[model samples]
Target chain A: MAKQAPGVRIDGLTVVYKTPAGELPAVRDVTLTLEPGTITGIVGESGSGKSTMALSLLNAVQPPGRIAAGSVEIDGLGDVVGLRGEELRKARGKHIGYVFQAAQNSLNPLKTVGKQLLDLGRSHGVDDLRGLVREAKELLGRMGLDGARVLDSHQHELSGGMRQRVGIMLALVLNAHLVVLDEPTTALDMITQANILKIVREVHAERGLTTLVITHDIGVVAEVADRLAVMYGGRLVEQGPTRHVLGAPRHPYTRGLIRAIPRLVGDIAEAQALPGRPPTLATVPKEGCVFRERCPLRMDVCDTVDPEAHADGARAVACHAVTVKEHA
Target chain B: MVVIARRLAGHLARGVVMILVVATISFFIVRSIPGDPIAAHTQKLIEQGMAPEAAEQATRVLYGFQATGSLWEQYGDYVAGLLTFDLGQSVTHAGAPVTEVLGEAAKWTVLPVLAGTLLSFLVGIILGVYAAVKRSGKLGDVLAVSGSLLHGVPQYVLGLLLSAIFATLIPILPGDGPVDILYEPGFNAGYIGSLAEHAVLPVATYTLAAYGGWVLAMKSSVVTVLGDDFILAAELRGMKRSIVFRYIARNAILPLFTILALSLGLLLGGAVFIERIFNYPGLGLLLIESITMRDYALMGGAFLLITVSIIVANILADLFYSVIDPRVRSGEEVSA
Candidate 1:
C-alpha cells in the first residue's frame, strides 16, 4: 500500500463469453505489462477485447463473460484475478481505476456529481467527505473546468467533453497506481479531444500515475501514448515503444492500421481501407496465425505454421517473415 | 426556469379544459339516458299534494329544464352550475344535496385506494429492483413469475377469493363493509381498529392486484437500465451493491410517477368494482346505487368529483416530473 504507482502485469490472459452452446473467445492469451508511471495506449478496432481486458482490471466483465484463464499482478497487491467478493471490491477501489468510453453513460444522471464522488471516496475508506470533495474540485480544476459547478451538477448538466473529463478524474481520484481509460476520446469533438489529451498528459506527468488508454483512433494514441500495443483478431500483433512501433510497424496488421489513418501534413498517401471483416472469435482458426486471411503478404509457410513472436529489444512482433530469427 | 414555468402553466390549462369537458359530459349524458330523472322528480312532486301540471312546471324550472332552447345553452348552464358545486337535487334520496352525498362517499374511496396503491408501489419498487439486480438469481425468477401471475388475476376475483378464504373457509376477518356493527362509529381506537380489520381484505385485494403492475413496470424499466453504461460505470467505481441498485432503479423508475398519479385519479371509477365486491362504502358503491335508484344529481356530483380529482392528480404529476429530473426543470437537457 505504501509503494507508489504500481506496475500492472497481465500474463497469458484469456477472457471468454459463455453461451448456452459454447464459449466465445474474446481475448486470446494476451500478455502485456504496464510499466509504472508511463502512458500506454491500446489501439484496436471495436470487439478486439480491448474493453474486456480493461474491465478485467476491475474484475467486472459482466455475466456470461468471465476471465477464462489469466492473472492480473499489481506490483504490491499480488494477482487481482483471483480475488473475490470484498477483497476484489477493495482492490478495485484502491488499486486500478477505469474510465468508460461513453460520456453520456459514464455517470448516473439521477445522482449528483458530489454524491458519485462521495460514493467512491467512501468505498475507499475516506471518511473526510469535505476534504475529499475539496480534492475532487481541484482535480476538476486541473482539467480547466469550474470545480463548484461540476461538483454540484448532474451528469446531464455537463457537456460531452466535460463528462469525459469527469470520467478521467473519476479514474484518477482514488490515486490508483494504474488508470485504464477505454476509448476516452471516442465521442468527443476534435477540439475537445485535443484538450482532453492535454489534460491527461499533464495529470499523468504530475501524479506519476501509469495509465492505459484504449482507442481505435491512431491520432489520439499518437498525440499522447508513450508506449503502444496494437491488437487484431483478439491477439496483440505488435507491442513496443509508441515511436518505434509507429515509425517502423513490423506486423502486416499493424501496417494495415497505420495505412487506415487519414493524413494531415505528411506525404498525403492515398488513404486505403483494410478489406474483409475481423474473424469471428468463436470460430477463428486455431491451427495458424489469425491474421493470415487478411495479411497482404501471406505465404504457404504462413498457412502451415503459427508464427511464434520474435522478441527484438523491447519490441515483439508475431509474423513469419517480418519477425524472422535474425531480424533487425 | 421559464420553460418549467411555461410547462406548468400549460399543464394547469389542460387540467381546466379537462374538468369542463367532464362536467358537460356528466350533465348532458345523464339527461340523454332513456329514463329521465326530471320525470322521476316530477312524479314525486305530483304525489306531494301539488296539481300535476303545476308540479311539472315548478320542478322543470327548478331543474333547469330547457325543452325549447338549444342544447348548447343547457351545456353552458350546467358547466356554470358545476363551478358552484350545484348538481341539482337527488330524486331517490328525497332531494338530498348531491354534494353532501358525494363528499361522504369520497372518504371511503380516498383512504383505502391511496393506502393500497402506495403500499403496492413500495412493495413493487423494492422487489422489482431486487429482481433486476439479481436477474439470474432464483429469487428474481420467483418474483418475476409472481408479478406476472398476480397481474393476470382480476382485482374482483382476488377480492372474491379473499372473501372465500376469510369469510367461508377460515372465517376470521369480516369480509364486508368498513367495520363491525358491534363497534359504535366514533373517533375512538376501537372503531378505527375495527375499520382497519374490516378493510384488510379490500386493501389487500387492491394492493395484490395493483402491485404486480408496478413490479412489471419497474422490473422491465430497471432491466433496460441495467444494460446502460452508467450502471457498469457505477459498479466499476466500486460502489456498494445498494448504491448500484439505486443508480439502476432511480432513472428507470422516473416514468412510473405519472402512472402512479393517474391510478389515484382512477380511484373513483376504478375502485367501484373492488369496493362492490368487498361491500365497502365507497364512491364505486355510491355510483352503482345512484344509477339503480335513478339519482341523476348524485351521479353527476360523483362524476364531477372524480373527473376533477384525475385532472388535479395529472397536473401534480406534471409538476413532479421536473422534481424527479432536474433536466426537466430547465425545459431542456441540462448540459452546460
Candidate 2:
C-alpha cells in the first residue's frame, strides 16, 4: 500500500447551507486527497459545490453555511473545522493561498497593482522588502508581463489577461503549501487561458506547491491535473489518475461529460449532448442513483436503490449497472 | 487634476447661463404680482405726514413706471444693474445697499449651515463604515434603524425639540440667533467667548437634523460595498479587514460626496425658514422684509445670489465627482 503524499486530507466532508427554505447540503459526503506538488482538478458544473469545497479550505464559506460533519486536515495544520478568530486568520494567510475567478474584479480598482502585491508579501511577515519586490518583479515577468510597469499601474489600466496573471502572482507570492484556484482562468480568453495554465504548471514545478484547480472545462483538467475528481450534485462520482478516468470513464455521468465535449476533427454526429439540466439541491432524488433520471442505463434495481462507488482497479465509479452487470 | 479643471470650466459656463435665466424669471415673477410699490410706500409714509398722492407720484417716477413700457424698461435697467453688481437701495431697510444688507444676513445664515454640513459629513461617514462592517449584529441594525427613523422627522421639528431641552429646560445654551445683544464680533476674548456660546444651540440643532441623512447614505453605501466581490477578493488576498474596508467604503462613498455638495447648495436656500425660525436676521428674513415692502431691486439681488449659489454648488459637485472617480475623465465623456 502506498500512502498519499502530504497535502490536503478530507474524510467524510459534508457542507450544509442553512438557507431560509431549510438546510441544503451543498457538498455532501465528499472525500478526496490532493498530493504535494501535484495538480488535482475537481470538474463539476455550476452548483455542484466545487466552489463550496474550495472555500472550505480557507474557512471562508459565506454565513448560513457550515462544515456539518467532517474533518479537513491539511498536512501542516492538523484540523481546520473548529478553528476561529485570529487563529483561523493566521492559519489561512500563512498556510493556504487562494486565486478567485474574475481577476480584474479580484484586485481593488482603487489601489495600484504594485501596492496590492507589496501588502500581500508584508502581511505574511516577509521582512526583506527589496527581496519581496524583486520576487514580485520576477513573478510578473514570468507571466509575459513587464513587471515594473504592471506593478506601478492600477487594476483598471490593465487588460483582462494581465489582471489575471497578477492575480496568480498574488496567490503564489508567499510560497504557501496549497493554492486553491476556483476557475482562475475562466474569465480569460482561450490564448490567455493557455498562458495562465502554463504559468500555473511552471510555478507548481518550481515551488513544489500543492495545487487544487477547479474548472468545468475538461481541457484544463487534461492539460494540468495529474488526477481528476468528477463532482456532480455536490458529490464526487468518480476519481482516479487523469489518464485512467478520461480514457475509460467508468461512471455513466463521467462518460456522458467526456462525450459531450466537441472534438476538433471528429464528425458532427459523434458529439454526444447530455439531455436535461443538472438537478437542483432541493429536487435531488432520494431514491436510486442521483443521475438515474438522466442516465441512459436505468434498470429496475436502479429505481429502488441508490448506488455507491465500486472500486475498479485504482479508479472508483458509482454506477450499479456497470459494477454489477459487467464487473461483478 | 486636468479632468477636474475641464469639467469645472463647462459647469462654470452653465452656471453663467443659469444665473441669467434665474434672474430674468425672478424679475417677471416678482413683477407679475399686481401691486404699486409707490402706493405701498406712500400708505406707510402718510401716517407720518407725507402727502400721499405726491409721494406716490414721486415713488412711481423714481421706479420709472408711468406705463407698461416703463415696467419693461425698469426690468431691463435692473438686469443691467445686476450685471454691474450695482444692487440698488433696500426701500424697507432705509438707505442700506441691497448687497450690504445681504452680506450681513449671509454671514448669519451661512455659519450654521456650514457647521451642520461639516459635522454631518464627517460623523455620517464614520458611523456608516462601522455599521456596514459590523452588519448582522445589534449595533449595525440599530444604526440603520435610528438613522432612517430620525431622517423622517423634519429639521424644524428636531430643532424645536433640541431647543426645548437644551435651551429651555437646561438653560445652558442660547435658544436662537447668531449672537446675544451683549456679545459682539471682534478679536476680544470676552466677545469671542460669548459669540461661541450663542452659536452652540443653533449649530447643534442644524447638525442633529442633517446628520441622519449623511449617516443613512453612508451606511447603505458601505453595506452595499461589503457585499461587493472585491471585498471577498481582498479577504482572500490576506488583507486585514480594515484595509478591505478602506477600498470598499471609499469607492462606494464617491456618489455620496456629490450628494453632500448638492445638499450644501440647497442648504443655502432651505436656511431661509431655519433662519426665520431662529430669528437669526439672515438672508431669509431680509428677503421676507424686501417682498413685504415691494423692494423689487433688493429682492431681485437676493434671488440672483441664491440662484448663483445653487449653480456654483453643482459645479463644485461636478469637480468632486471627477476627482474621486478615474473612469469619469470628462463631462463630455460622461455624456457620450
Candidate 3:
C-alpha cells in the first residue's frame, strides 16, 4: 500500500561536530526541500557534509556531532529536530526510512534476514509480525529476489546487489513515505550499480516516495534523481532540476565535479581531476567561500565573504560572481 | 542434521587424536624423570632391615608395575591400558586406581572451578558491556581500571589475600580442606554447608583472578561492535533502546565465546596453585602430589585429563559458534 508521499522542508540546518579544538560546523545553514513524490540527490565529495545533512532528517547525527541549528519539517511529522527519546525513535522507521551507506555491512551478520526483520517489527510495536514478514517478502519479491530464500539467508550469503535490494525492502516494508538512501551504490560493479539505481527509481515511483539519495558520484544522481543539490565544504553550493544542473552548472564547484567524471566516449584527456583536496572539518573556512581556493573565477571578495544560495526560478546557485552577473 | 552429525564426528575424531598425542608424550616424559618410586621405596624398606628381594617384591606390589620392563615395553603396556579405559594404579596411594583417585579429587575441583569461572564470565560480561556503553563516563573508567588490576594479580596471590581476610583474620569460614571431617559425609546440611564454606575462598580466588580479563575483553569487543555500521543502522531504524542493546550485545559476545571455552579448558590446569593455597583437594593438588611422589601413572592421567578437557571445550566452542552465527555454518557457500 502506498501512502501520499510527504515533502520535507529543511531550513537553516546547521550541524556541528565537537572536536578537540572546538565545535565546528559540518553543515552550515543549508536550506533545501524534497517536494512530495520526487527523488532529490545531493552530490558531494568526502567531507562535504552531504551525509550530515541527510542524518539531520531523522535527527540521527551521533555524539561528537549534533544538529546545532536546524528545522527539518516533514508533512504530518512536525519539526523532527524537536523529537527526542522514544518519540524521536518511533518517528525514524515509521515516518522516515534510511537505507544506510554500505548496505552490505548493514545487516547483522549473526542474524538471518527474517529474524532481523522480525526484530525491527517488534521494536516498532507492530502487532502483526506475520503481516510485516509478508510485506517484507512482497517488497523483496518486487525487487526481483527470491523473497523466502533471501529472508532465510544471512548477509554474507547475499551478493552486494542482493543486499542493497534487501536494504531497500527493509526501508519500505514499514510503508514510510520519506526514504533516504545514502551512497546506495558505492561499492558495486557498474552493471550492478545501474541495476540498483533502476530498482530504486521504480520503487520510488511505485511506492509514491519522496526520496533523498546522497552520494559522491555525479553519475548516480544523473541516472535517478529528479532534482540535484551540490554540496561543498558543508554548504549547498547549487540546487536545480537534474537535467538543468547537468546541462548548465552555475557553481564553480559543481562544474569541476561534473568535469572530473570519466566518460567512456569522451577524449581521454578531456576528463580533468579537481585541483586541491576537499576541506575537512578543521580546514573548512570559518568565513569565506569554501570552494574559492580551487575556483578559477575567484575574485578578491570571494576571499572574505561567503555567498548565500540565491534562488532564481527553479534553480539556485550560491556565488558572488553569479549573483553579480544575474543582477547586471 | 547431516551437517551437524558430520561436524560432530569431525570434532570427536580430532579430539581423540589430540588426546592420544598428548598422552603418548606425557607417558615418556614422566618415565624419564630421575628416581623411580618403586626403587626408592624398595631401598627404604631394605634400610629398615628387610631382605633386599622381599623389599623389592613388596615395592613392586605397592607400586603396581614391573620395574624391569624397558621404556618401549612400558609405553606399549600404557597404550594397551589406555585402549581398555584403564589409567593404571596410583604409586602414592598404594592400591588405588589413578582414575578412582583423580575422579574423587575431580569431584571437589570441577564443580567449584566451573562455578567460579562461569560466575566470573557472567559478571564480567555484564559489567564489561556497561563499561563499554559508558566508555566516556566515570563508572566505565573505574570498572576498566579495576578489571585491569584484578587481571594482573596472580590467582594464588588473590587466594592468599582472600584466605587472609575471610579465614585467618576473621575466622568466619574454614581455612582449608574440602569438608570438615566431623560432619558425616552424606547429604546432610552440616556436611554440605561445611563443603560450601570450604569452597568459598578457592572459588572466590578463581573468580577474582579471571573476572578482570573477561571484563576487559568484553569491553573491547563491545567497543568494536558499537562501531559497526549495523549497530548505527539499528539505532537509526527506530529500534527501541533495549532492542539496540540486545543487537550490540549479541554481536559483541561472539568472539568471546571461543576465549571463554579456552579459559574454561585451561583453568583446570591453572587451578593447581589456587587449590594448593587453599588446600582444596582438586585435580591440581592431586597432580602436584603425584609429581612430588613420582607417581607417573597419576601424573600422566592428570595431564591427559587436562588435554582432553581443553580439546572438548574447543570443539564445543566451534559447534556453538556455528549455531549462533549462521555465517560460520555455510562458510563455503558464503565464499561461493
Largest TM-score belongs to which candidate? 3
Reference-based lDDT, residue B34, model 3 = 92
Error at A193, model 3, angstroms: 1.0
Colliding residue pairs in candidate 3: none
**CAPRI rating of model 3:** medium
Residue A268, candidate 1: Cα error in Å is: 8.0
Candidate 3 overall Cα lDDT vs. reference?
Answer: 0.90
Cα lDDT for residue B150, candidate 2:
76
Docking quality tier of candidate 1?
Answer: medium
Off by over 4 Å in 2: A1-6, A266-270, A285-288, A299-307, B44-51, B54-84, B163-173, B188-190, B329-336
* Residue A231 CA displacement from its true place in model 3, Å: 0.3
Assess each prediction's global lDDT (C-alpha) against the native: 0.82, 0.79, 0.90
Tens digit of per-residue lDDT, candidate 2, span B1-336:
555566677788888888888888998998877775667777766777778787777666655543355778877887788778887777656657889988988887788789888887898788877777677799988887777877888888877787788878998887677666775557888787777887776677677777778888887887777777777877876776667667887787888988888888887777766666667787777788788887877788788878878888888887777667665543454355
Model 1, position B44, has a per-residue lDDT of 77
Q: DockQ scores for all the models shown?
A: 0.58, 0.48, 0.75
* Rank ordering of all candidates by DockQ, starting from the highest: 3, 1, 2
TM-score of the first chain alone, every candidate: 0.94, 0.93, 0.98
Model 2 lDDT at residue B49: 78
What clash count goes with each model? 1, 0, 0
